[model samples]
Target: MSVTKGLVKVIKLEELKPQIGKEVQVLDQTIAIFRLTNDEVRAVSNRCPHKNGPLAEGIVSGEFVFCPLHDWKISLTTGEVQKPDNGCITTYETAVIDGYVYIGEPIQHEKHDPSR
Candidate 1:
C-alpha cells in the first residue's frame, strides 16, 4: 500500500491488545503501539536512540517504556528520552476512524484514547 504522504497505515486497532504493546511495520519503519491506560493509547518509533533498542518488546510503566535491549526509559507520549541525554526517534501522528488506526507520518499528539 502506498503510504499517504502525511499519513501512515500502521495497523488495525483490533490487532492491539489493551494494556499491551504491539509492533506494526510500515515499510522500513517499525511502530510500537501501546495502551498506556484505560483511556490512553500511544504510538512511537520502536528504535531507541541510545542504542537502537527494540522498544516494542519493552515493559510499560505509566507513561514510559523501558527498553528491553538496554533498559533505557522512553516516554510513549512525547517520544522523549525519559532519563538519558540521547535524541529521540521520529514519532507519528495517530488517529482512529471506525476502529482502524491511521498513523500520521510525523508525531502528532493525541488527547484521548479511541480504544475505549
Candidate 2:
C-alpha cells in the first residue's frame, strides 16, 4: 500500500496479535498499537496519564486499556481517562492498508519525567 505523506508505517497487521498491545517508537515518542478482535486498529501514547505507567503492558478490554500501575481505564480510541480519573494521554491517528499499519503524527502533550 502507498503510504500517506504524514503517516509513518509502524507494523504489519499480521505481526500484531488480537487484543495485544505492541510498543512502537517514533522519533522520541513511544506509542502503543492495538488490533482488536474485529481487526480494528488503535493507537495511543504508551505512557499512562497517571503515574506514567507503561500502557503497552496494560490490560486490553474492548476498546479500553487499564493502566498497569493503578488500574486507570483509558480509552484506546480517544485517549481519555475514564470517569473518576481526570487526565488524558495523546492519541494518534492510525491507518491500515494492505496489511500494513501506519500512524499519523502524534498530538503533542506535556513530557512526563522519566524519574517519576
The TM-score values for the models, in the order shown, are: 0.75, 0.86
Per-model clash counts, in order, read: 4, 0
Q: Estimate the overall C-alpha local distance difference test score of candidate 2.
A: 0.86
Candidate 2 to native Cα RMSD, angstroms: 6.1
Which portions of model 2 show Cα errors greater than 4 Å?
1-3, 107-116
TM-score of 1: 0.75
C-alpha lDDT score of every prediction, in listed order: 0.73, 0.86
Clashes of 2: 0
User: Which of the numbered candidates is closest to the native, going by highest TM-score?
Assistant: 2
Best by lDDT: 2
Candidate 2, residues 5-71, lDDT tens digits: the string is: 8888889999999988999986677999999999999999899978999998899999999998999
Residue 30 displacement (Å), model 1: 1.8
Worst 10 residues of 1 by lDDT: 106-115
Per-residue lDDT tens digits of candidate 1, residues 22-85? Answer: 8888767788888666645678898888888888888888888888888887777777775435
Question: Against the correct fold, how does model 2 do in TM-score?
Answer: 0.86
